[model samples]
Target: MKSPKASSVTIALILLLITGWLLWSSAAAAEETPYIRGAALIDTHGCLACHSGNLMGAMKVPPLRGCELPEEEFQAWVLYGCPQAQPGRAQQSRFGMPAYEGHLDPEDVQDILAWSQIAGHEVPDQAALSDLARGEQVALKAGCFDCHGPLGQGGIKNTGSFTGAIPGFSGEQFKHLCDDGDPAAIEEWIRHGTSERFLSGEPLAGLGRSFMSSQLTKMPAYQDILSDEEIELLVRYCLHINSLGPMSAERYEAHRAALASSKMEVTGQEDSLAGPSLPREVAELFSSKCIRCHGPKKQKSDYRMDTAAAAFQSGDIADFLEVSVIQPGAPRESLLYQFVSATEEDSLNEVFPMPPSEDERLSPEELKVIRDWIASGAPWSDKQTLQSAYSD
Candidate 1:
């Protein structure tokens, strides 16, 4: 009813407002899409708990700060755990990823995928070729960091019924193992895997084959898993770390001296009716079963049971031992006892039982030793012996 110019202006203004609203709505949706959905999915599924450095038994959970994986592979891993995608691949930690097959909906999987891609993309790609940097990248991609730590500083990896302390690459022992300047021996060891004990002239002993074969997680054969180039990179990385000087050189030397001075003394006679004193027996038990993860090189959960002082003073270890790990005069209430006694079925819905893997669980006799040790006040008398043994 108004003039044509006035009507046209009103129509144009309406169109402009509508267009602005649509554009703003689209932008808002785009901004919120990936991160919002992905973060929610990750949180709800408890992915952060494992990936963000929570201890699952003795294993040090690799930080997921810079995780990168193919979309389909990531999805499969999240939904089915490790066995489905890589059948014989060693589990990442004592408590490996739980299969979210029935738990996560299809949309939930998609959201998780979106989150992984977004989070991964946020981290800059490693492009440096320096020995240290390149070596780290190689180790990270090869899953060495899962057991060896992000900096190759060493950690623990379950090997059969016991745990093995992975030596830090930057240590004198590791340097000696690598044959100083030559990395060929290390390369060969990687290529052939653990089957052949010696590589070139270097002895590649220590990892017990019988024990390895009996466990669900074993050192993987790089010949099958990694390319020649990858192995070479790892060797180079090890060499570079060795060149950087040993971690705590002074401490290492002092420890070496102590070991040299200490005389080999038997704890108890072979046929002694009374088992070794609680301290000696517990020391042996810890050395054989616990030190790998809680020793000097790797202190998963900041708990170190290798030495008396470390066990009693490192982080909350003392409290945990007193309360959860060892309850004086009450083995049944002890979390350590409970964990060791847990069956495969008990761990299905939650984290896997202590030692985590079925094959690595303590034997009935071993369990009894632990129970008796706890019931007897968990005394720690032979501190000097443990300190001397674990000096390295």
Candidate 2:
């Protein structure tokens, strides 16, 4: 009944309203909230007391913050609690978070997730710049690569041959098999149980025990250090690896080209004073040279020169030795340095100079780097820094 001009104007008004509403809804959804609310809620419920303020579950409790639990599994855990809560049992769940169903509503669970996400405590962001590198480190620390091949490419499958059995899966083939597989499924298998589908009926005798026995069985349970979300991110990393396969060659080419172009930029940066300062270089040198012999390998003569990990393992790097060496924060107190730097009389007397006679002494530059690095808090830099810088 309205004139054409009037109808067009009405339609325009309706479209404008729709657009405005959509924008507003999107902005609201994207809004950032303070992590304090979530942190407080966790604290309010005594969850922090058991789970720790950071939500890194206690000794008896599995880590919850970084877990990759699927929504349904998470729901099941909260609602029913674990079917078996006793220790030393095969149990319905590997961890003990005590089902929250009767005590906390579904809304409460959602709020918990929301709180966790805000605190940068939830499963780490898949889009995070460090996700892949961090995931790789987790995989290594967890020994995922021992069975799954480097970079989760999976292990070689053998069908048998005139030359016995050969590694059946190349890195590419392994990537293909694991692509897009549910992280939750892997977690379920790891935590709950695994199937026989791994290597099928292949009789790989020389390969030693099957993947099932070698890995799923032997690997130490990490319900302590890792969380559900972290596992999810790892699975996501598996997918990312698979995705890289189809275009891997092209990507490699592009990478090479970029490296070629950036050579000057890279060289310039390395020359810049901002390059890994003295302390880092020194720490790295120590890790490479001294740690191998004096540290964990033998701790020869009770002198373990291993990384800070050694010190962390013993709490007092001094206790393992006949005398105290490091004062932490202050390298001046670190006897390890003085021993290495010992000029005849300063040597730990009867204690053989580290690395002994056969082993090489630290290069002058190496020693300086080690000294500086030790004094600088012994920071272990991200893995890719040195490699990427030189590659560029």
Compose the digit string of candidate 1's lDDT tens values, residues 1-392: 69999999999999999998787455322122333455667878778877766576555555544345555666567666753454435345324777777677556766665444434432113643343344456677877756553344454444443234454565554555456546776776567654342333433234344444565555566887877767876886666445433322222222222222222212335533432235455667677666666676787667666655555453453353455555444556556567678887865633236665677678888888777666544555442434324445
Q: What is residue 64's positional error in candidate 1, in angstroms?
A: 15
Candidate 2 lDDT over residue span 1-392, tens digit each: 89999999999999999998787455322111222233345666667566554544335654456435655565566555653222233233345555555566665665555444322222223343344445655666776655444443332232322212111112333332223254544454344334233333235433333434543224345555678767765665555444333212222222223222222322455544432222445545555555554543455545554444344232233454535464323344456665566555445453345545545666677666555544433343232122111111
Report the CA-based lDDT of candidate 2 relative to the real structure: 0.44
Report RMSD for candidate 2: 26.1
Q: What ranges in model 2 sit over 4 Å off?
A: 1-280, 295-297, 303-307, 312-317, 320-324, 347-351, 381-392
Candidate 2, poorest ten consecutive residues by summed lDDT: 383-392
Best by TM-score: 1
TM-score of 2: 0.23
lDDT values of the candidates?
0.54, 0.44
